[model samples]
Target chain A: MSADSPAGTHPDPTLTSLDIGHPVYAALLDPDTAFWALVDKTRVADTLAGGPLRDAYRQHADACRRELHALRFELKPSGVYLNPTERCNLNCRYCYLPESQRRSGGHMSVDQLLASLSRLRDYFRSIMPEGGRPRAIFHGAEPLMNRDAVFAAIDAFAGDFIFGLQTNGTLLDDGAVSFLTARNVSIGLSLDGPSAGITDATRHTWSSRSVHNRVLAAMNRLRGYGSWSVITTCTTENLPYLTAMVELFHAREVPTCMLNAVRCTLAGARDVKPDDGAMSRAFFAALDRTHELYRDGGRKLVVANFANILIAILAPTARRLMCDISPCGAGRAFFALAADGNLYPCSEFIGLPRFKGGHLLADGGIEAALTSDAFRSVIGRNVDAFSPCDQCVIRHFCGSPCPAEAHEMNGGMTSTGVFCAFYREQVNYALRLIADGKADDYLWDGWDDGTETLIDLAH
Target chain B: MTQTVLTKPQTQRASSPSPAVAPAIAVRKTCNPDGVGLSHYVLMDKKVAR
Candidate 1:
C-alpha cells in the first residue's frame, strides 16, 4: 500500500516488514503530509533495502541502537537510592515497604558503604565516556532514622559525589538542617499537604503522634538550606486536597514538587488506589492550578508532571533518562542499593527476590550484577513489546509500563499498568499546549525570555 | 495578574506553521531521574514541540 492509501488498504509492505502497527500507521497517514516528509519512508526503506539514503538512516539507527545498549551497560547510574536503614518512625498507610522489612533495623556499616561507593565509582568511570558524576540519594523507611550512617556516607563520598536525602521531615531538627546545609545536600520531604487533618490521617508517627506541625516546622527551617523539594504521594484519601497541596507548596516557596500516584502493591496495605479516570482528572486539575500559579500568581512552584510533559514534547531527543524512555529506566540508568548490600533494579524491587541483581560485594560487583541475565531481562522489556503501549502514538514520549508498577498491578513485567490512561491524557494535554503556542508557559527554567521556540506538535 | 482557572476542555488546536529550521535530533543525555538538573537540557535555540 502507498502512503495515500485509505484505511483498511493492504498494509505497506515496508511498514509490515518494519512491524509498524495500525495506530502508528494512522499517525503517519495524518493529513499533515509532513509526517511522511519527516519519516521519508522511501528513504528509510531504501536505506534499509540498500539504496542511496541507506548510509544515513543506517548510521542514525545504529547510533540509537548503540546508545540503547550503552544505557543498559555503559551509562553509569545518574543516582543510587541507598536505603541506609529499614527503620522508619512513621507508619504511613500507603507505604509499600513490607512490614517485616520495615521492622528490621538493618544499617549499612561504614565498611559496606565504602565498598559500595568504590564499586559504583569504578563502574561509572569505566562506562561513562564524559566522566559521570553520580549522586548518592539516601532513602529509607526513614533515612533520618539512621542519620549517623547517612552522615558517614556523606562525609566519605562528599567530594566525589553529590548527596540527596528523602525523609519524612518530622525528624529534621536544627542540627540536621545545619549538617545538610553545610554539605549542600538536597532534601526531599514527604508531605501530604499543609492541613494536619489531611496529612496526619496517613503520615503519623509509630506512637500515633500527629506529624503535621513538626513537618511544617522543618519545611520552614530548611527554606534557605541547599535545595528543598516536596514529594506528595496522591492516594484517594488525599485526592480532594490535591489543589491545596500545590497551593501549600507555592506558599512555602518550594522550588519543586512531585505529585506521585501511589502504586498499588501486593505487599503493602490496601489503601485506596485512584482509578485512571480519577487520577487523570486530579492530575490535570492540579496541573491547571500549578500553571495558574506560575503564569499569574508569580509563584515559582515547579510541578514535575508539567515539567516532564514539557520536556517530553519540546525535547524528545534530549530525554536520556530511563524514567522517560520506553523500556522504563529501572535497571538501566537507575538502581536501588538495599541496606543489606544487595542490589535491586529499582526501589520497588528491594524486598522482592525475583528482581534482585546480586550483592554489592560480588567479584564483578555492580557491573556483574547489572549485566547479568536477570537485570538484562528487566531492562530489555520495552513499550514496543508491550500491548496497547506498543500502538500508542505517545509511546516515545510518555514513560509507560513502569517495571515496578507493572509487577505491582499486573503481576508481570511486560504489561502496562493502570496509569496508562493518565499518561495518555498528560501527553494529549502537552500536545494541546504546544499546538496553542503556549509551550513557553510550560518552561520552568533554563531559558531566557523568548529563547525557546515551539518547532512543531508531532502527535 | 489574576490566576485564571482552566475550566475549558483541553482540545487539540490547529498546527502552527513549521519553523524554518527543522527540529534537531537530540541524543539523550544522562539525567537525574528526580529531574533536579533537567533544566540544563532545555534548549535555548530552536526546539521541536512535537
Candidate 2:
C-alpha cells in the first residue's frame, strides 16, 4: 500500500486515466476495513482486473461479502412500526397498501391494540434485558383514522416507550396535538410537495379543500408545541421541485427532511416513479441547495437522505436509514405490525402474504414472528449475494434498497432493485460532494437524539 | 451527471488536521498522505457500536 494512497490501507497503483463515469476520481469501498474513499481515476487500477493488486481487492471484497452476510442474519431490534388502521382519508395515488385492505374498514380494537403493545413490550424485554425503551411509530393508511385504538396503544405503553406518528397530518387537530405532545411523540408528516398544486395531484382528497394546507397547518401546530419533521415522497409530479420544496421546509423552520423516492412497490407508485436520471439530478440538486442553506443559514436544516448517505459512507454501523443498510434493518431492527395483528418487515410489504411473519395475536407471537421463516427470508437477503450489486462500487453506501420493493417490482429479494440507476446516480453525486470537501455541509446532528427529536429512527 | 475533470494529485500538504478513525475521508479531501489519521464522527443518530 502506498503511504499516499487515498485508501491508505489499499495500494494505489498508477495507470492511464480512464474517463469513467466517476470522472476525476473513482470512489472505492475498502472491503477489508469497510471504509470508502475517492482515488484518482489513474490509481484505481490497483483494485481493477490485474495481478497482485486485483487479488488483494478480491480478498477484501470477499470479507465485505461475509460482513453483509452477518448483518442479514442478525435480528437486533431497534423498534416496531404499528399500523393502527388501514382506513385513510385521502386516496394517495402512490400508496403501496392494497386498496381492498385499506377500504375493508378493518382495525385493531382497543383491547387488541393493548394486547399488541403488551407483546411489543415483551419483545423489547427479550431483546434488551437491560431495559431499553422501544420506539412505537404509529404509521398509516392514516393511523389517525382509528383514533381510539391509536390513543389506547399509546396510553398502554405511556412512558415505557418512545413514540412517533407517521400521519397524513389532516387529522392532527388540537385534540390530537395535545395528546401526542403530552406523550412527547415525534411527529413525521407526509407532505409530497411544498404546496397544493403538486401534493393535491398525487395525494388526493375528497373534499373541495387542499391536503397541503391541512398538512402545513398540522406541521406548524406541532412545530409550535414540539418536535416534528416532514417526509417528502419524491415522484414525477414533484421531482422537478424537490430542491425548492426542501428550501421551503428549511425557511419554515422544519428540522429534518426525509426524501423518500417513490418506489415501484404498487401500481400507484410505479406509475409515478421518476425517471432514473431525473430522480438522481433532482435529489442531488436538493442536497446541494439544502446543504448550502444549512451551512450558510446556521446549520439548522437537515436533508436526512443526503446525511444518511454520508453516514453510511463515514460510519456504516451507526446508520439507521433502513433502505441504505445491506440486507436492511427490515425484519431485524424493525417490523411493521398491521392493524389485524399481522406482521411484515415494513409497511410496504403489508399485503404480501409471503413476507408475513406471523400474527401478533397468537401466543408468544412477537418472539416467534422474529424467528419465523418468512421473517428470516426477508432479513436474510444481502446485496452481495445478488448479481450486479456485487460488481458495483457503491454497494455498501446504497444497500441496493428495500427488499419488499425489489420483490414487488422484480421477482425476488435478491434481484437487482428497480432503483439501481437512481442509487448509482445519488451515490456518485454524494461522493462528488465529498470529493469537493462539502461533507460538513450536509453532515449534521443538530437535533438532540435523546428524545428522538425529529429523527425517524426506522425511516 | 457533471463529470469531474481529472487533475494530477496535489503533493502540497493540507494545513487542516488529519481526521482520526476515518482517515480516508480527510485524506481524500486534499489527496495528501499526512491528512490520514485516527478518529470517528458522531452523527445525531448514535447506537452502541457493534
Candidate 3:
C-alpha cells in the first residue's frame, strides 16, 4: 500500500498477508517489496523467491484478491422466494422472522408458489449474464414446514437456477436431507451453541422445553448425510461461550461454522443490541484460544470465517468471497418474489411494507415489477448512495452496507449500518494482534509461501 | 492616505469561547493502525451532534 495513496483508493487485500507475526515495520520494510521500494537492485528476486517464504507471499497475494471482490457478483437472473408455510416447530425468542404472521395463516398455495417461481425463472433467463445461473433462497417461518411445495418448485426450476434454504433444524428428517442432498441444494441451519441451557434459552418447541437435543439430532443426521453445517448467532448471552461453541464443533467434527452477530431487524429478537466492544474481545480471545486448541488437539479450524476474511485480504491463492455487499443484490443480480407474487429486493423484506414492489399476477406479471419505479428506485438508490463508503480504505474489501439491514436500522439506503461499529472493532483487533509480539508465532512464522519466510515483508 | 494609529496593547489576547460546552458527547480512542496500547480512551466532546 502506498502511504500517500488517496482515501478512496482500495488497498490490495493480497498484500496484507506477507507476514502475520512480524512487526509491521519489518513487513513494511521487507527486502522484495520494501516500504519505500528501497533495496539494492541485485537482491530483490532472491529475497522474495529464493527462500521458504516464497509460498507465503504467493498465498498472501491470492488471499488479497479473494477479499478484494468478496462481495463482487454479476447479476444472473432475478429469483423468487416462496414463503410456503409460516410455521416453525421451534420458537426461538430471537427469531428474526416472527412466527405471529405465519400462525395467522400467512402461507402460500403450491400453485401460487410454482407460478411465482416460473415468472422469476423467465425473468432471470431474460436478463441473465450469458451462462450464469440465477439463484433463489427459501427463507421463512421454516421453509421445510411446507416440504411438498418446496420439492415441487425445486423440480420445476431444476435447471434454471441454484436453490438454497435456511432452517432451524427441527424438521430435518432423513428423507428431507436425502432429497436436498440428491438435488445438490445448499442448506444453512440456525443453532446458537452447545448444550440445552445455551441452545434452549432462545430456540425451543411449543412446550417451552429445550430443543437442543432435537437440533443436535438433526445436525448429526445432516452430518451423516454429508451436507449441512450450523450458523451460530452471536449474542450477549452466548458471547462468553465462543470458545465452547468452537470446541463443540471440534467435538462434532463439523466442517465449518459461521458466526453472525444477533440481528435486530423488525422480525429480529427484541432488546438485543450488538455490543461491539465486547464482541471484539470475545472474537479475538476465541480466535487465539481456538488456534491453540487446534494446534494441540490436531483438529481442523472449524470457525475459519474471520480467518478466511484475513486470508482473503492477505493471501494471494484464496478463492473470491461472495456476499451481497451493497444495499442488497436487487434487480441487478437478484430480486425476491414474495409468497403473494409481489417482488422484493430480498427475503428480508417479505413481510415489510417498504420493499413490496408490485404483484406479478396483477400487473403485466414479473416484467412490470422488474421495471417498476419502486423496484428500480430501491436498487438505484442503493447504488447511487455511495458517499461514506467511497472514501474508506477498505472500500472494495468491506462490501457495501446490507440493503435490508440499512432499511430496517437507519430507515434508508444512505444510513450507516448498525454493524459499522462492530466492523470497526474487528479491524482494530486485527491491527493490535499484528502489533503485539504474537504476530510472528501465531500468524506469520512458518506460514510457508514456498521460500524462506515467504511473507517476511521485513526482510 | 492617513495612517491608522496603533492600538493599545491588551494584557490578555482576544478571547475565543472554549469548544467543550453543552451536552458533551463522549469520545473514545480505541486501537487502530497507530497510537498507544489497545484500549479505550473516553472523553466528552463539547460540541454535541444533536
* Candidate achieving the largest TM-score: 2
Which stretches in model 1 have alpha-carbon errors above 4 Å?
A1-76, A267-270, A447-459, B1-50
| Model 2, global lDDT | 0.65
- TM of each candidate vs. truth: 0.76, 0.80, 0.67
lDDT of 2 by residue, A1-459 (tens): 111223224344322222326445555555323445455555566545455433444444433334343444443776778888877788888788887776665887888888888878876876764656767788878889898888887887886677778888899998998888886777778788877898887886745357888888887786654466678888989988898898888877877768878767786688888878888888878877886786687755777776677655544543446567666777776778988789887777887888888898787587778788888887767766678776666676777877877888888888877778887776666666665565556755421222111111110
- A173, model 2: CA deviation in Å? 1.2
Chain A fold similarity by TM-score, each prediction: 0.82, 0.85, 0.73
Put the candidates in DockQ order, highest first: 1, 2, 3
Q: After best superposition, candidate 3 residue A37: deviation in angstroms? A: 12
Residue pairs with colliding backbones in model 2 are B20-B38, B20-B39, B21-B38, B21-B39
What lDDT score belongs to each candidate, Candidate 1 first? 0.60, 0.65, 0.51
Question: Each prediction's DockQ?
Answer: 0.06, 0.05, 0.01
For model 2, state the Cα shift of residue A453 in Å. 25
Name model 3 segments beyond 4 Å from true.
A1-22, A25-81, A129-131, A224-226, A267-270, A297-299, A302-308, A311-324, A361-367, A370-373, A376-391, A428-459, B1-50
Better of 1 and 2 by lDDT: 2
TM accuracy, model 1: 0.76
* Decoy 2 TM-score against native: 0.80
Candidates sorted by lDDT, descending order? 2, 1, 3
Which of candidates 1 and 3 reaches a greater DockQ? 1
